[model samples]
Target: MKRIAVLGMPNTGKSTFFNRFTGATASVGNWAGMTVDLMMATLKIGEVTADVIDLPGIYDLRGFSEDEMVVQRFLESTPLHLIIIILNTVQIDRQLSLALQIKRLQIPAILLLNMADEAPKFGVKVNAEKIAQHLEMPVISMSAKYGNQYGKGYDAAIDAIAQTLHQQEHPICVRNISDCAIDDRQLATELDAILQDAVHISTQHSNTLTTRLDRFLLHPILGLPLFFAAMYLMFQVVYTLGTPLQAFLSFGLDWIKVAALEPVFTPFPSFLKGFLIGGLYDGIGTVVAFIPVILLFFFCMAIVEDSGYLARSAFLMDAFMERLGLDGRSFVMSLMGFGCNVPAIMGTRVMRSPGLRMLSMLVIPFSLCSARLNVFIFMTTALFTPQVAPGVLFSLYLFSFAAALVTALLFKGQFPNHDPLVLELPPYRFPTIKQIFVRAWVEVKHFLRWSNQFIIAGVVIIWLLNHLPMDVPPASKQTLSGMIGQAVQPLLQPLGINSQLAIALIFGFVAKEVVLGGLAVIYGASNDAGLGGAIAHQIDWVQAYSFMLFTLLYIPCLSTIAVLKRESKSAKFATLAVVWSIALAWITSFLFYQGARLLGF
Candidate 1:
């Protein structure tokens, strides 16, 4: 198989082009920093399968940025037949610079004028022939956003790959490096000259549709409120609409447990039944049932993201984010962390600087991941009034953002000179069904893939610990899990958390959703009563709030810790994070509990 490396500057629809060619659901965002990792897949053009690699987006081949380093390292290691460069036709003048730099390298390549449909809206026209003639390479104008045109574009793109591969010895005429420094102003001027005669931009004296929408959505008076409202609606969807579907799924899983699996377990030994049915099956079931809520969230997020509203969101937030010494683009990662922290952590790869990525890693945990959301939903519904549940949930989210800001502020000096937000907001494109479903599916799969193993292992471990000491009552003080929880109970006294809650926290360290499952086991509450109802018997509203606060602030799950360890590649850093979060969780919750008591709550 031949090889083609897809390279481009950020927000040029490179990932979209790759996705179209390979049918891989690499994330397609309207802003920069979306594709942070190397994506490789097989692209079949007719009968030939070519190995296609989508490299990290780069502004120049200067090897200064983290993503540039990623591209540099990969290129040095891999042998390639053709270099496919994706360019945003709407940003042709700025986008052509990278192409010019690559052309100087004398590599066999083709320039894909991606997102061509947006060219007209931007009042820009690309003369592909002129670009090709001057650059001495094939140039094809295409739009990945338009599904109808996507097929033709993709087909032509694949054919271009084939053509480039065939011309292996016949390299595109290389431009001389001469006295020009790679990223110098002279080089940029020269690159601009290559397109001066090829491209024309008409004056947009009046406002366009996007400009019209921005008037209301990004209006100074309404933007912040609108942003908060969008966030509120996000949480509301998970709780309001997701609840009935979650209940239905939970009911199905429970039926399978009792009506199907329990009978099969009746003849088995007690230990085996507990291990299989109670430990493995029930544990996996508890987490899997929440898949609906996770899916719903990603679906909503994808719509907002692909619609280009997220960029405006970042624009509105840039001022505040700069105050915290972080880029507003990191806000995207923060919001993503709400769905799942692993990818959110991974998403930090798009940050160009080490300081910014580190800052994002430290801050993302405060974003209230979906795993934590399960516990939040259960506990909030259990203890708070329905009239106030949404508000309570929203407050938790608000607190998360607050915590992240505080975290960023405290650590800002360590990461001095963090990258400023220079996001380019793409035009609002009504997301095709393909775009929405594909993006949502990618996130859902990522959640499941990252979570399933941890869920199963964590569940089984809890079951073993809770069931040990053969004749002892389940989750009693004498049991292994109970003894551990008891040992730590003294530390939690000020915050009013009991042994069961303590044990749940200890295991919740494994996975946050397990807090509910562990509660069900410790409280000996049947699935019929609900984890929330089961827990409502044990703790009052004040204790519940303290409990929720602790859960929110505590150490992230083992999986997150593992990823942090790997990403930061610093054992000490990861250890410090664990210790700091525990201390923070304890102190914050203690303060909330004590302060509330003082106020007569």
Candidate 2:
């Protein structure tokens, strides 16, 4: 197959462009380092089928960092013929330099001034024909993300690619080694001179829309607080809107259990009824009810991201997070973890250092992910007043970062990411309804795909443990989970954790969303009349908060652990992750409970 390599500097939408043509869902983010590996897919251009490879984004073709090395090695090993280099038209000042360097390679190239649609809004204009003449290559103005949803400018790009690939019969590189060894200083000066005539910008405008907004959004004092405020708002909205939807979902599930399911299972044996209807059905249904919260959280994030504010947040984050031995870009990974930790772990591939990538992988699990979000929603709403519920849930998010920062610092000496993180602030764009909904739909679909299987499997396992070895009345002391929780109760007593919560935690290890279902199964409460009230009566607010803290800090869900193992390529590191987190959860919960009691709470 003809090999076409998509190359560009970080955050130019290379992966986005690649996904458009290849129809592959390679992770695309608003920040840098999204494509850490060579993601290849089959592209059939008109009639010829070629192999499309999406290379890691880099500033210079010269190998500098781990990602750069990966790019260099792939270029050397793979016989590539066409290079599709994407450039952000608004930031041509920085991006054009990379294109100039690629020009030196004398490869068969097609340059895309992507996101050109946003250039006019930012008071910048690019003459693609002029630039093409200056660089002696094909330059096309287009937008990859816009193309991602609609065929606005996408069809033209595909035609250009197909025509270019068909015409370029020679190999990608034909120049001698000396071509890239030219004087760097003189080359940059010459390149700037060439681009001067090809691009136009208004210098009279000091306060563009982006700069005007950044005054507050990226202020030295307010940036961090605003970021937190944004986070708090996201959760507040999630809880506020999600709770009612959660109640609605619970109603549907209760109807199914009593009216739809119970009738069918009426003739079954006690063990089967208890295991399937009450245990499995009730357990899975409880977690499913919280899907609205998950959906809302992702929808809000999608809007924030599409508006280009998320990249600015990453730029702002680089300043404060540097103290933790991580750059602000790590903030993106941490937030992605809120959706799911597996992709976030894979996202560490964007960090340049092997050690730094590992540090990022470690920091992510501590982020309060959606799986744990369900458990928090249940505990906070069940335990606290409406006025206090958002506060409690929001505080847990704060603690998530608190724990993550401490974890990053403790591992600072062990894993240091020395290279400074470089991120370009993308021009702020007005988010369109279509873009927002598209993003929401994709996330909702992913949430269901990534979660449904895990949820069902975890719920079924909890059902078995509650019923097997004896036909114990569901959640009785003789159950297997009960015996195990009893054995561990003394260890957890310091944190005011009871036997039921202990068993729930054990099942939660499979997946945190299961904790609520585990509660319903163990407490013998129906979905509509389930453990929410029981938990409120069983434990005081102090213990409830303490229990929430313990849940927040305990080990990563099984899927995260498995990914950590795979990414770190060591069982020992994964084992360390499990041990460290559980230890922290225990100690943190213990101190909180004991101190709260002493303070007369």
Candidate 3:
């Protein structure tokens, strides 16, 4: 199969272009740093099956950012049949320099001017044929975002690929060092000539929508407060809409357990039946019930991200972030961490400096990931009134940021970053319903995949621990789980975490989503008394708050640790993350629990 690579500067709509053919919704955020790693998918161009690799966005071939290194390494190591370099039509004058650099490599290539529909509005005009003639390569002007569907651009792109493949020359096997070593000044002069011949921008045209929006959204005094209010409102919508659906799903799942599965297990022995129903059904079902909530949160986040406000938020936070020895890009990684920390850790590759990347790795794991969101939502609803539950959840999110800030402050001296922030603010666009749904479904599928990989196994293990020895009452002090939990209970006692909760925490090391499953198994939550009821009966609001705090501050899941080890390339650094998080969690929860107790809570 032929190999093609799609490359571009950030926010060029490259991922959306890739998705047009693959039918896979790889993250399509209207921001820089979204594509931190290479994404590969199969492409078919008229009976030709080729592998298409979407590379991380980079500004310059010689740039020192880890993402630039990624692109450099791929080109140096991997042979390629073609390179599809995309440039935003509005930014073509500046982006064409990257095209010139790639041209010097002597690789077979095509140039795609994405977002062509918005060019005229920005008072930009691109002469594709002129560019093609000047560069001796095919240049196509098309909107990747809108042209892929019901538009001629999609068909034109496919046909262009098919023809190019049929007429292709030898594949690129090695770097053309002499050609690539051309003087930068010469390349700049050539780039300017090409732009003068093929591109035009009217001085009268400006993106009024972006200008007006940024005036308010990026204001120094009001920007931060507005961002916070928007986030709080988003959380409110997710909870208010998702909670009822979650309850309905939970009820339906319980009905299945009692009405369907119970009859199937009736012929088995009592112990076997208990394992099937309580260990497997109840435990897994409890976690599954929250799928609606997860989907809602992802959906809301997708709209915010695709509408292009996420990048603005990063810019607004840059000043505060720089004071902590980081920058706006690191803040972007932290916000993305709210979805999942493993990818966020990998996303740190966007940092140009090693010190900044390490600092970001230390801070991102503290973001309140969706898994922890599941746990906090469950606890707050069970322990607090509806009127106060949103406040409790919001407070947890605040604590997540607080924890991240403190982590940065504590570790900044060891790892210092002097890299200045350079970020692009894309024009705001209303996200299409199709894009919103696709993005949300993609994330939901990810949650389900993680659940299958970790939560089921965690539930089974927790059940075995509680039911082993075949003599003691389930979850009793003599059982394996109880004994294990008791061993660590002493240390957790000050934080109001009991033996059962201790065991849950141990299981949660596998994945935070499994914490809910472990709790359901430990408590033997049934249709009559659901997990919420069991939890409410087991712990008061204070103990529940303490557990939530610990969960928020402790080491992230094992997958995250593995990514940290791989990305940081240091077992010692990964180990330090674990140790520091545990210490911080213990101390913070201890102080809160002690203070609350003293206040007569």
- lDDT of each model, Cα atoms only? 0.77, 0.78, 0.85
Clash pairs for candidate 2: 317-328, 318-328
Listed in order, each prediction's TM-score against the native is 0.90, 0.86, 0.95
The candidate with the higher lDDT, 1 or 2, is 2
- Cα lDDT tens digits, model 2, 1-601, are 6878899987787766776577654443322333233467776798767877787778777766656666766665555678889988778887887777777776778888888777777678788888889878888888887774543456777788889888877656433434465568976886778668878887764436778899989898988889889888887898899999999999998888888888899899877887787778877788788888888888888878767788887788787788888887788888888888877787776676777788888889998888888888988888888889998999998899899998988997888778778776776776666556656666777666666767676677776776666745555668787788789989998899998888888878887877887787776632235668877777899988888898988999898898899778889999989999999999899999999999999
Which candidate wins on TM-score?
A: 3
Residue lDDT tens for model 3, 1-601: 8888889998898877887667773433222233234667776778777878888888888757788877877787678888899889898888998888888787888998888888888999888899988788888888777765535766677778778876774578556444478578988898888888989999899999999999999999999999999999999998899899999998899888878998988999988898889998888888889989999999999888878899998999999999898888888888888888877887787788889999999999999999999999999989999899988999999998999899898889999998888888888887777767777887888778766799889999999999987798898888999899989988999999999889989988889988998999998822247678877887899999999999998978998998888888899999999999999999999999999999999
Of 1 and 3, the candidate ahead on lDDT is 3
Residue 585 shift from truth in candidate 3, angstroms: 0.7
**Maximum-lDDT candidate:** 3
Superior candidate under TM-score, 1 versus 2: 1
**In each prediction, how many residue pairs overlap at the backbone (N, C-alpha, C within less than 3 A)?**
0, 2, 0
Q: State the lDDT at 599 in candidate 3.
A: 100
Candidate RMSDs in order: 4.0, 4.3, 3.1
Which whole-number lDDT from 0 to 100 does residue 240 have in model 2? 91
Task: Give residue 304's lDDT in candidate 3 (0 to 100).
Answer: 82
Residues 28-81 of candidate 1: C-alpha lDDT, one tens digit per residue = 321233323456776566555676777878887766776776676566556667
Report how far residue 205 has shifted in candidate 1, in Å: 5.6
Q: TM-score for model 3?
A: 0.95
